[model samples]
Target: MPTYKFKYFNARGFGEVSRLLFALAGQEYTDERFTQETWPAEKPNVLLGQMPVLEVDGAAYGQSSAIARFLARRFNFYGSGDIQALEVDQVLGVVQDIINAMIKAFYEKDEARKAQFMTENKEEKLPLYLGMLEKLLVKNGSTGFFVGKSITLADVTVFDICDKIQAMVDFDKFPQVKKCRESVASNPKVKKWVDTRPVTEN
Candidate 1:
């Protein structure tokens, strides 16, 4: 096995999914966390000047989604076949859209503008994306896993995103989605890590 080093900020942000993947896979890696003050000095050395870069045997890679997908494949969490993999990718895309909207709302400085974004997120964006996710979960037989009988990358992705969404919106209407989130969170490793992971404003 190659030496794995995951570099990211102290915050969970985009990197938590990758960390969760490692935990779920029972893979040991160096968790290299940086603070905002130290990031500027260290940024230039990163492959893409981005957080959540994964280094395998000293070779660096950037982009959180790609890194998560790579780790998913490495850990056999991607899926069984091409179609299943595509399904996982589709779920990942939807999760990314949700995160993007959340980030926009999170970073808005003005109270009124932030309120508007939050309202739109809670009222419009969350419902649409989450409703779609709920439908997909139902289509997959409501098994609590997004792709196959076992947990896949899609499940992991959804679990992380929904876990975040729960802070901003109640998922009571999307029972399937809520159930899926509970399923992932109930995993022994996932639960342990989530409970112990560093807390951040984001």
Candidate 2:
């Protein structure tokens, strides 16, 4: 079997999705976690001088998003048709945008600024992106799944983002997002993924 080694911060900041994909695909991987002290010195040897890089058969692959896309394609999780694949990619992008906005809020100077960002996040970006998700979901005739009416890379990516957000924000006010997350969160496979997954905390 080809060897798979994933190096990243001990946290799940960026590497979680690909790791979960590996699990769901029933693939064995070497999950190597590192801290700054180790990463700065260790990273130079890799392709991009970064962690979260995956080594498959001694070939290094950087960029978390690209790594995720590659892993999804390998595992049959990308989606079905061209349109479905397109929607999947677009949805992942939307989720990424929201996550980035929220992370910005998390790292700001004062509580007031952080709270302001959180408020703006809940009021603006959250609904803008998640509302779109709700519509696409309903358009897909969502029987509680995102694309192809089944589990796909998009659903996994969305679930992780939504779940991570729910941990920080009060998402109850956004029922569409809450419902969307619940749908994905409740899936047996996904529920198991969440249950066994490592928390992205220090």
Candidate 3:
């Protein structure tokens, strides 16, 4: 197979799932990271000048969520039945909202604003999203995953999100979230996946 070039950044943020997805699918590729200074010169050279773009035999496709969904459908992490597949997609959508809120607030930052954004995140958005996920988990029987029997795209991304928050999104009002997060985080493959991924400043 012709190898792909996955161009992202210094951290796991958007590119982590692409990495995990590729790994889980048993596909081979080069995972490349770039600093901000280098992007200006390098990005324009890519087919679309954007990323986490996946290049398959040198044809490029952009959009992180699109990449994730496409890869999931291809690899069977999307769930088995039609309804289950849609459920897998729905859960992923909800999880993406939480991911984006934090990315908007903290990831793309000037050095000075971290403290203030962290306060805003904990006090406002974090709890709301966490609570929603916990409730969804509880509603679904807290089944050690978001969808059906096997791990899906939602499971992979949520596992990544939970690990991202350990240093920050503490369990005060959101204690139930710990159960949902722990269920996936403890999966041996997922634990190893998160541990191996490169840390991004974002």
Between the candidate structures 1 and 3, which one is better when assessed by TM-score? 1
Q: Best by lDDT, which number?
A: 1
Candidate 3, residues 27-93, lDDT tens digits: the string is 7787878888888888878766777888778888888888888888888888888888777777777
Which residue pairs of candidate 3 clash?
A: 11-199, 11-200
Better of 2 and 3 by lDDT: 2
lDDT ranking from best candidate downward? 1, 2, 3
> Candidate 3: TM-score?
0.82
lDDT tens digits by residue: candidate 1, 97-168: 898899899899999999999999999999999988998999899998888778888988888777677877
**Highest TM-score against the true fold, candidate:** 1
Q: TM-scores for all candidates?
A: 0.95, 0.86, 0.82
lDDT of 2 by residue, 1-202 (tens): 7889988898877888887788778788888888877877886688887768999998989999999999999888888768888988988988889878988998998999999999898778877888777777777775566776666788778777875676555666555456666766677655786688666683
Which ten contiguous residues of candidate 1 have the minimum total lDDT?
160-169
Candidate 1 wrong stretches, greater than 4 Å? none
Error of model 2, residue 151, in angstroms: 0.9
